[model samples]
Target chain A: MQKEKPYKVKLSIMPFWSPLTPPMGIACLKSYLEQNGYSVRTKDYNAISSLFDFGGRYIALMKSYTPVDRMGNIAMVGYDVLMAHLIAYNNRDDFSLNDYHELVRQLILNNFFYEATDEAIENLCELVEQFYALLAEYLINDIKEKDFDVYGISCYSLTLGPSIFAFKFVKKYFPEVKTVMGGGIFADQFNSNSLELETFARKATYIDYFLLGEGEIILLNLLESNFKNVPRIIVSDKTVKKVCLDDIPLPDFSDFDMNSYPQLVAYSSRSCPFQCGFCSETVQWGKYRNKREEKVVFELRSLTKKYGKNIIVLTDSLLNPNIDKLADALLEVPPEERFYWDTYLRVCDMAEDMEKVKKWRKAGLYRVRLGIESGSQHVLDLMDKRITIEKIKSNLQNLADAGLKISTFWVVGFPGETKEDFHETLDLLREIKDNLYEVDPHPFYFYPSGQVDSESWEKIYGYESIYEDKYNEMLMCTYYKLNCQPCREEIYRRLELFRERCEECNIPNPYSLIDIYHADKRWKKLHKAAVPMLNDLIHSGSAIVDEYRDSIVLR
Target chain B: MEMERKGIIEVLAAIFPNQTIDIGDDDSFIDKLGMDSISFVSYVIGIESKFDIEVPDEYSLPSKLDTLNKTYDLLGRERG
Candidate 1:
């Protein structure tokens, strides 16, 4: 009567991730496994976390984009503080309350935040422990519900610590269930020598296997081979040929609660052709590859029909690599079948193609997120972001004219950036204020391993020194010192100034809420009066802390 | 108190003209009336303008002022 299901596996992503859309990584893996005829299930703890009263607040922070500067991000600072305590507790059996208090004290001393009292730190530690147990209860209950053979946890940059916590739960509760870990975090951490990957595997004994690079092929290989003679850390590049975008099955969102998210997530392309110096996207995805336009259109039609959501968010690096062809393919679909989409774009000759852009608009390209890294040509050149300022301005005007919302990002405090260069960025913001829908300003972070040409950038700029803080076995922090103008303090001042300029220009930055909360904490650090004021603000039922409840419907 | 309640209903009606005509005082803005985040913010602004009272940013949250009764209660505290 029914076909027998084989090779039962459950793939999950842990909490403290964005609930705005379903995770694309797990969805892709789930689809690939099903296509290969393996029974697969997904546990989206990240999405489900929004249902809890406390987890809802965390999800809200996770949903908002944080700048590269961790201290400036209320979300990042809060997450890192809790994670530092959790990791330390996990490592030591005799870890005491004082250890957590000391750990938080170290964080405060290291300039992670302005200040926190001993009592506050103690209370926060208790709350985090309770939250972890609650998350584990949910995880264990789901695992117990079905006898899954393999449990895979997808680890992103933010979810690394939580995923480790999840693996511990799986090993403790269901020891027989094989634990596997994979995602962008591995892509960032894995080095050329394989030494780092080896060290990570040895340290995380709970994770039986690590699927590096893309998961679809390696995961299927592991399942088929029955985990025999497979390396504990299976690097995708070493194991299988680069996956053809055309051959891979479309991402399966059927496993996810599609109604919970505002927009459905899909990506037509793998990576960007342009190798910007400050970018790590190309590192994660080796080379640029795209599906055939026909396949993309088909995916659109099928996904829209199945999900009943017309607004699709493409997680592609840049959707306009082959703009003309893609636009034409989308236009081939009739008006009714076409669905609304938003994607990242580069300021290339494609923007100058007014007719093609109009076709893209007609074909449901409602938003274009542009990495206008800097308004200054000098900084742009230094970052190896080839697009010129003149071109950026023209493109913004063109896209805005075509009824596409131009969400532009600017980087503050790139190496060698001067006061005048910073001013040029401000001037550009003012110039394009009318055309801009949202302006997100982020501080420049230099991840030596992640960048394409950090050596060249460092040599040319004559940076003072690079500092790496290996806080624990798991977390490694990196900080760069600029020998040239605009020190870190000045850089932060510029970030605040950038926000002020946005307000003066009347640009509606949805991220302003998080920034305001961050500023309040900074003010608390500076003034005693700010302590009472902060308490008042928190007790007043402010949306900054309480709005997470409104972001999603309670399950 | 009755007049304050009427004023709150009038403000809600102005913000969401079509939805508020037959809305019960206990109807949740989000659940019963199907108000989104933006409309909720507009309703807050509408209440502030109509009643000539400044609603604190904290109290303006949808969870805090989701119903006419809640808005009426908030007004009593503000007036006091």
Candidate 2:
């Protein structure tokens, strides 16, 4: 047997993706290919996008630690608008920019993007067009500068439209380059019909191969087969070539300019263990998998040494799954050599284990992010969250007492969440306000195929998935309306109340600037006057953040 | 200076309602007035809009505009 000649492979990620950290998807592919003796080059076109003036401001809002409530909705609208344009571009039909503005206005009228003003919507439409043109120019110029056998684009939730847009440029200008599209987004099933899959399939002429599931094994197989006799749609799960978590080589970040990013990223695990009904992690990744604890620690140390970064952000869905073995391994690293890291964790009895929690802090777990979700135990049980309110409160205190900065997420409108249940959530926030470092309150969304027992739960919750008129077909996820108390408007009212409660309690919201600005703008429109409620919210939330920052300065 | 100070107070009052923000010209925002970072930024934007001026990017920080006198001076420079 002879070693196959390595293909000149180049993988890239497009804009609307965050530049705060190097993407783990392409890094994994580059390492898998290079280890198998292939030449690989990777580029962070997102970092390049951030270099543009408007792009800088757009991405700064993303980087401002804003929660997904309004900001995420705005990003969703942008993604949809770009997708509409891409469809027209692929069909060689003219897409009127004003049509997109009207589409957004209709979305606004249809109870979506309610946070955006008409003026903001207009600017967002123009910005999306400008960014698409600029990114296309940058991508084409880079393709001209290099020659590669395969060009891969890693698409995520926000990057799908832009990713395909970039691939169109490559297919048009560099036809010889075998264009491949792959990412976790492909594995995500947002609706019952999988509209995104169908939409992309229509334009599949621009893409040579669409790799589903994990890319490492499928990519290796494609390269070994010399890109011949391969199916246009390669599903990793269906194929026999599957990758085990432990066997894959460490992700190579050398291709990325590590200095441009604030934190270095690595994952100790893939997928998540819990099956929360509202979450889509288990849907995208069928089951949970973890690397050996020693392997994880070794990778963290290697990344810190190689990149000279002191802050590491573990991209794991939940570190609690392997926190015991992983934290113990990390403790073995001498304190002086230990790098600070943070990750998402589940609230369970393990958090109450003061000894283990303190050991995690000693092991340099800088911040702990928890999906507290709700305060009503009934609502929590409804979501299959499995953790009790008593346990949640005690666990929050234990983690805070162990000197961990706790950032929490609260979902305002779960299916069965009553007004009393919402107040319970507010009460829970007030109870743990002293311990919380950041508060992120989000409105609930239903994805038919993205969650566990989604269909059955939809029946149980008595809600139907309607394709929200003509404009919503371009949306990545399905639109749903609850047919009970606390309808959409009620949910938004509660969401506003939730934000006001956090401000009233003086718990720092990371997105207070954007939140207050939008609130002030909306208030002026509705009431025709400047109000003190906005100021009160800001003044209260600001005190906590100012004090928090001042303590950091003192430390 | 007095007119500017009076106008600044009116703007601050509108921005930070429900509070009695008593301060001398030399009083510090953080220590004397308890103005948090968010309040400070809001105040700057408020004063800029009220005065029809734009503060330089460098002087928008709370530390640079800690005192009403300091804010007044910065506005004078920007207005010049």
| lDDT (10s digit) by residue, model 2, range A1-555 | 235465789898865565656888999998888878888889987655222234334434332333345343333333333444333333322335555555555544444334445666655555566766777667767788766889998877556667767777788877888888888666454221356466556546778887777688888898889888888877766435557878888888887766456567899888888888878776566568889998898889988777876667898999987887787788788644556677999998888877777667666676678999998998998888999999988998877765566778878788779989999998988887767766777777665555676677667666655444344444433456656566776676677677677777766554323243433343333332122233333234212121211222110
Candidate 1 residue-wise lDDT, A358-393, digit = tens: 667666675789999888999999888888988998
| Deviating ranges (above 4 Å) for candidate 2 | A1-6, A49-98, A110-121, A187-196, A238-241, A458-469, A472-485, A511-555, B1-80
Candidates in order have lDDT scores of 0.66, 0.67
Query: After TM-score superposition, what is the CA distance of residue A534 in candidate 2 from its true location, in Å?
Result: 29
Candidate with top TM-score is 1
Q: Which ten contiguous residues of candidate 2 chain A have the minimum total lDDT?
A: A546-555
Per-residue lDDT value at B63 in model 1: 58
Task: State the fnat of candidate 2 relative to the true structure.
Answer: 0.04
Model 1 C-alpha RMSD vs. true structure (Å) is 9.9
TM-score of chain B of 1: 0.82
Docking level of model 1 = incorrect
How well does model 2 score by local distance difference test? Answer: 0.67
